[model samples]
Target: LLGDVKAAGTEVREEYRWTQERWDEYRRLAEEMEEAEPSAKGLIFLDYGKQTLTSDGRILNEYRFAGKVLTQDTKWWGTRAWYIDEGINRIDVLYARSISPDGTVHEYSPDDITFSEPTRGEVFFGQGTAMSLTIPAVDIGSIVEYGYIDEEYAPEDPELFQPRFFFQSGEPAKLSKCEFEVPAGRELFYETFLLDANDPYIGQTIKELPKFVGTPEPVITRTDSSTIYTWELRDVEPLIWESNSMGYTTIAPSVHAGLYPDYSYYHERFGRLHREHIKITPEIDSLARAIVGDLESEKEKIAEIYHWVQRNIRYISVKGALASRFGGHYAQITLDNKYGDCSDKAILFSALLEVVGIRSYPIIVMTNDAGFMDRSRFPFWGGNHAINEVWWDGERHVLDATGNLHRFPTYSMGDCDLYYANYVRGEIVYNPPIPAENNSMQSVTLVELRADGSAIISDSMWFTGDMEAGYRGYFEYMPEQRHEMIVEQFVSQRKAGGRLSDFALANIRDISKPFLMEFSYEVDDYTIEAGNYLLLEVPALRYSFPEIELSDPNFGKKSDMTFMRTHDVTFTLADNYTVRFVPERFELSNEYFDYVANYEVDGNTIRFTDRYRVKKLRIPISDYAEYKADAEKIMAYVKERIFLSEE
Candidate 1:
């Protein structure tokens, strides 16, 4: 019963068949018990999963779920489990059994399982189907157990395998164990992560399991014979969601097992596979030429191509078998369809670059989970995202085609300064860091105070790099009416009861240039009037400074903070008013940041300028106090007011 239920490229035997009548009967029984009363504090008794790898390169995975439906709210847990895939032929739900509180037991054969195609949203273009069935005779205190097996050949490298086991779950477990069995004489390699070396229960069959040292580096082990690796955790507590916890994979105890000889094999294999699909077709060449028509500079040409891809190609997630996930479709197909996932878009862009004689390579990256990569853990399945890197102007530029709103030559903030897989080189590479100056915002404001206690202000703001990317993304996705509302809100927030007029945005669609926005507004009662005297307060050009308190317990000790800004303002008072008070020039500098502010008055005009920048993007936890102190200093300087009086 434990052997291969069905082999690859082999017919299923008659003994494994289940008739349609049996399925209908099980469905009827489930429906009859749909109204079962609820239980208190739904709890799971056991949850187990297992996987076996055969010498023939086929993976068989199995799972067993045993839980009690304590209450109506928790009925969904024990009702059903689904094994869904577009490649349904490779999936099989063996059987299900349920024992009621009164000791009556009911069993469901394979034929009792129901198969149906579920509806998917447009965003999921080519997702497959689902095979699902409800457990029979389930009620309060009932024990429901069901298991299924799935077999699939790894698309990229059949011999390469990645196995992960979580030692914790949302529900407390009495026992949890993950076991891996490989055919004898097959090369086996693995690394354990986030496990306590001091734990006495941890066991391994290999003699060369690296000693658990101080740091939590991956412990690598290799064996030639058929190997069995088991990781077990007893009396585990429920994993509670913390406010700002790192990724689950980072904190969870698990093992990554692979059969590949080295990282080089993965890189070479995937590089070759991906290159085969990146054909430079005639259509691609023509499109590239059209996009870069008569553009002399390489930067300009790249900008044009990058912009075109962002504007034209749509993003749709199509997850299925390994082939569809790893061996993405050709670039031409993506162009024709006008939609593709990250890999599809990356491949298409790479092909387009090739057409223009520009050298580029596809890079595997993790968008939000960069911590998953460990230098010691060399596996091909490192990254969940794929992007392209372009070589231009003697420098490398990372491009993410799915970033529809990002400006050319500047990638989204998450895409910058991260480690990615250089499959061609068979190693990991850290992307070049963007300077704080490149990711900056500058604003200029002119204010004219009237005798009527009202004022007219004209302001212009410019954004570059990641700051530009944010505004550009807003303009791209926001409708015209909503954009106007946002502008109005922006003006009102600075000056209460302010009205905006002549609002204009520049370089919103021009990806190669910085983003600009200019607006004129009038605020009522801008000055406080007291019996033949007026008091005017010059508003701060920038009101908020990023704050990261070192004392905050929830603050991630490993995280870093970065910020940069510049502002200049001029206030022209009416002839009746005179400058009464002005903040003196102020300067503050620390290891983490620098700030400079100057205020000047000449006749009826007051001028002020300020600049603040974070010296480093990554501040160690030990330096958090210094960074926080610098930020506070900058905030205090900006909040200082300049006063005007009527003569």
Candidate 2:
């Protein structure tokens, strides 16, 4: 489709010439990485590749990697796919080629590249675009290299231009570098981070000012017209992946460059950009009052308004809406369309709360899963997502109405326990972490075993925090036809011939309370019956425990992390058969996690109770071995079964 459009990247005004010395260096690096990571598919000769920012607010990005494919699975690396935001930039494929083991070179044609919309998951609208091509005759042991450039012509705010370079990735690199050329009279602030995954001090005090994380050591070159700054790293190994580890962005060595003076610049600039659009019109006021309907407590009013926007406003991305990559659309326009994205929802919710006499400000968040956003690092556009912060009764509460599942004071786990930047508050503030008890799941199951090894079961499960948000969000967005099938599928998942009856859900749309699921189940054979004995265990609960595995070799070497998983279960049995044995109480407690399960039996009844809670968020490597061993015991305890001998 881009046949006639002018290509900016492929012309190759100046491209790197492959010399014998460069080729020899690549061979030596390839041999080193292949021996160290024999199981890896490929190794990069150059990563963080070629990046240059000109003085006129235009940026150039090019990656030239002479990487050897160790396996057939990665031969597709020769199939080029370049992501672009065509709305503001033009791209050119300067060069692409593949060199086989026997030194056969297959050069790719830049003219062969074509343009199409990028494949983002279910996102129907955006400035996202892509360029593609297929290099000929690439195979295992082939070294493929490619380069491209994208130039942004129109930047809404040139002063807010901040470019960050991440030097480390999952693929090991021989060398990675970023360079910038700026004109005289303009000074750019630069900070380089060198976070070590194995450093106990860095991991334990990541949120606090980390000592070894940041250093502005850029190589500077001066000329009469301009100055250049460069940052480089060599012999960089790939980051190791560990189970339950924090995001790689936390440990990745990176350099951030920005012209903005301080963090307040972001707060002031963003607030002013969207301030004109966040007006509370008569329509918004009427809607807000109607939604609250004389709710007296400020907290109640906040919940009513937050939940209203979540259910009423549809979430759909639009090009140029937040594509300027900051702020939101008008609150009135969002209410008129009955739909908006995350930023739009936050804006509308903020306006509605304002109408109800509650003080609120829109804020930006970098979400827990995205990466670590250190204030010590020069402040740029740190958050990838936007929400709102409210001040009520001398307390600060950060809330998100982007999804319908979360209740007041509880939000998506991603938005929980992170630092955020708000326009009103020029200083960065911390949103205190929600206690593990708030994000919990409680379940109850009653089983009655018949003489023929069949059982009738009644089940009810309750959810709060993220647990409530996930299931409720699914039901809210899921198709109506699939709802019944989803409920029925739970029965068969537990037992082969099981059927569900009297299934009911609570608070699916009401975000004021914990989400609840209640159902009755009947299974043909819940146990194996011998001549005089029945072998049975607790019925499989719908939600199982978090799969905690420390099998990865890098577990202790990588950053330690703890997930919030609090679960409580109670199982009651109604039967006349004499119980021969009851499993003893099993408890494992440590700084990492807490687990306990015990059983009680009386006359013709048996009660089994289980509770598990995560005690810490960051588990140091020193404590991991003990945590791993205890975790294994809990895994075994849950699967343990008691033999029943009938009278």
Candidate 3:
């Protein structure tokens, strides 16, 4: 079957043989593919066989193809694959050519001195059909072809061959369905976009360029059913009502029954796995002993173990076959054998912690690649990653080991917004975080215009706990470059009147703390003008506010929706400037808690301060109207311009 397919195309010919030697060679290749799980299209593995092969599907002269002697004897097996081409070429191919009882075909184009013609042989197994080839190697040439194949080894579906590209998530969505409670005036809107049926990539496709994942469209929209897409709309009330700070709302009985893949399916799969693998692991035994031996410190011990597992095991992505084969649940395997996927590591770590008397469960997280996971919808393959949930001392904390960061148990700001599936009180609920905001920094810069055309600049900044972690991690990855980049951006804010020649930085206070970055800068000729009196303008501090415009017609006369971030900065200028202007203050005032902004001056120095401390975790969208009013006022103040006037 494999050999005959190679012969049909003018580009190459296929041949096969059924001799004992040939059988042994192919058997090894088949086993290699099964072991690596490269069945997911475009996954490339390299050959570690006795013989070395180049990435361009080239075999060294000393290798054998179809039992025909080349330059040397073929020693070992190497079956790595990537989706280099679509159609018949994309299938598994052992070397380039095969010879059995069918016919002979070209497998590889070698850069040989002789340019020898491909030898003819008989086909043994597959003949006349384009054989699938799996070449295990890194570097799938940056771009590859993608297409669909049928179960019968025939080109069953739409035969359009297209170029496929890789996309990673950009910024993660900060809000999901789990964040809010039903209020009398506010309606909850939910939208989910499915991938195009024909898209080569799985999961949502509305991603920023270059990266596959990022913030979902703030405004939910639609796309083709087969291609990755989003579901979003105007203020549609919730199908089921929720109140208080409850974990989740139950889908109606009718909805549950009609929903695809009922909770019962997950329950059974998880239950069986727990009975078989989890119940017998040493992790369980150790945990049981810990609980009984020392009741006093069991809580701390369990927390420590949970943290340890997350730190030691890094997340390697194994999306396609692993999920399909494992029934889309979490389980642990050896790090060496485990392949470092999100669920595999989470399951292992959770079970390990469980053995040590810690209560942990698998967490299903929709990666940045997929839009938010709405519990209202039933999906089999929406989310692409899994984490672990630990409920200790009545508090739930999420753990992500597969992230691209280090020394972090919790996810970053955007990552924290993913939905998870957990057995809560014997029921599976799609869980999102209670908070609908992200951690970030707010940096305010103040520029002092001088008569000499130079300026004295100062900056103040604050960070959230998670933002600090990310900042520090980034610095660790590239200390000099990251630090300089940050410093440069700050200085750029000091736009001078002319092409400033000299640039200087000073008073860079240490930012080792977990939630704040404080520093100031002094530069010369920072954008000064030479017309009578000097003109000075102070740049507003960098805030975490979303970039919004109210002009879009798709949305009704509603203020743009924004989320929370971990920052607040204000700039104050002394009234001594010839041109006097000041920004107005704004506030988010509710009876419970408010984030207010105000400015004050004391003698030579001006003072600006911003306060952001939301009292409640969840804020209903009905409250957005009031919040938007406050935010608009504050932003207006910040956008106010200051200029220098000469007498």
Candidate 4:
């Protein structure tokens, strides 16, 4: 985050200077890079950059690039976009000029920049507006330079202080430097991940790093009134693209500095605000009772209230002051309005649970898709969303009411494997990545092959855990009349001539029970024609594999998680045809994945059972070849067709 204060922002200095000697150094660096890495020569690369954090909590983020139109690929580098949150930060452009190859310069004015919706990249503007600028006239070599100061003189919450920096960028850099200056007596908790070769905890999260001891030791120097820490890197390479990569944060050379001693300190400060907003009134008590009136067990009662919040509260992205935005408004206020953001819903949910004598805490977290976060030792206020955690039956159940659709005790997929914290625990808690079994789908299908080369297929499916939320959430919004059309669309995806016949559903609305759905469809030309045989594979069956290519020898491992799926099917043929051929029965098991398929034949019917389980999520670089081979084999085996010779 660039800044956190609104009105009390910083201003850039009037005078700025750049030396001709600096340009000469950049030119030499660019020439060296072009010769060494020809593949990257046509792409843009950073020549020089510096990020400085002042003792007064202000930031000076600056950059200078080797700019040229060597190819169409480098043309896009002429434009640059910066996110400016009018409410949280005030940004002042220190200098934005392009020095032509002929030593002439063109500077951009205030009128040249346009404000629009902010985009998430190296910077997360956080629901703020963005300012973009397009450089002028760049046919030959150029040196583009720009710098800005983000002022957050006063933050909404003084206790919330997290100033982090990533030494690595999306593009290669010749020189990059970062400095942090804090008051001499002020202490900060910090950690660095994958920063350099000296880092022992590379590609691993070290939950137990000694306090204040970072691998890439900075140049420590003390001023009369402040302590300055400096870190520098030279000839840094860009992070190459990898399929299903966790995120740039996971691989970057970064350091996160926390103002507080630990997570407990931040919780003690903000948790009080959280409790203040969750005021449980008589109205909340009455509603809590009414929700679980018919429910029997504690799990049922919890499910009822959780689902009630999901269905009732409408999500509105509205934030006022810092207190209201972070701690949320009163529970009664959210209930009265019938709409609120993620934090508001979480506050209301926790309040209702308290009314029923249940212990629940509103936990703040950065979702899995966002990126990995430092769990607890360093208390950084980086979480952007809030959810509820209920303590019942000697266990904790994580629940999210924001998505507007989720079963009891089951988090939305994004909510899993998150860095979670709450005022109640006063400690660090991270929901480790879940196994495939935790979120799974099971299906059964019955098919009837007719004499005229047509087939009727009926599927009964059951979803559990996260998969349940995924399927049930989609149909919850669909009108009853469109259910048939939706099922028809799914069928048409498999076969063009497939038409929906009849369908039935169970537990679509009643999330307390496992989600179950049944649908049937008819397909024309169901089998391939041979001289004396009919050939066809099972209908309504497909595997869900990551779309990774085996073509790249330089490809790395996958950091993404896959799910578990099981399918059982029964197929019957007309009296005129015989069950002549069936796919081979096979079983394959490995550390990362497991697969088993069994095919049985009896009389004119064929039965098949298939189970695919992802034992582990990430496929490391060393295991990529083996994982790819097994994945490809499964894809091929599933495509094997059955040849039913006519008798």
Best by lDDT: 4
Candidate 2 regions off by >4 Å? 1-40, 48-51, 83-87, 120-123, 195-216, 321-324, 376-378, 475-484, 507-514, 528-535, 541-548, 555-576, 615-622
Tens digits of per-residue lDDT for model 1 on 166-259?
A: 6655544545566677777765566666565542212311112122223323322345645666665654444543333334555455567777
What is the alpha-carbon lDDT of model 1 when measured against the actual structure? 0.65
- Write one digit per residue (lDDT tens) for candidate 4, span 1-647: 33222221233245555567766876776788677656663434444444444556555454555544455555666677766545556566666667777778776665556677755444122467776767666544666666656555455654465667776554556655666666677665667666655554342422122222234767877877766677666666655555565556665677777566666677777688889888989999899999889766777778888889988988775665776677877899989989888888999999998887778888888877766666743566658888888888988778888865567676666776667887766755777656676678888998899988789989988877778887787887788888888888888986779888887777787766788888888988888887777788876557656634744433334435556788898988889888778989978988878899989999988999988887665455456667778888888888888898765
On the 0 to 100 scale, the lDDT of residue 636 in model 1 is: 76
Cα RMSD (angstroms) for every candidate in the order listed: 8.5, 4.2, 18.0, 4.9
Estimate, for each residue in 373-434, the C-alpha lDDT of model 2 and write its tens digit: 66645675657788888877778888888876678777766765567888655757776556
**Model 4 clashing residue pairs (backbone):** none
Q: What TM-score does candidate 2 get on C-alpha atoms?
A: 0.87
Q: lDDT tens digits, residues 38-84, model 3?
A: 23222211111111112232222111222221111121112222222
Pitting candidate 1 against candidate 2, the one with the higher TM-score is 2
Alpha carbon deviation, residue 517, candidate 1 (Å) = 1.6
lDDT of each: 0.65, 0.69, 0.37, 0.70
TM-score for model 3? Answer: 0.50
**Clashes, model 2:** 3
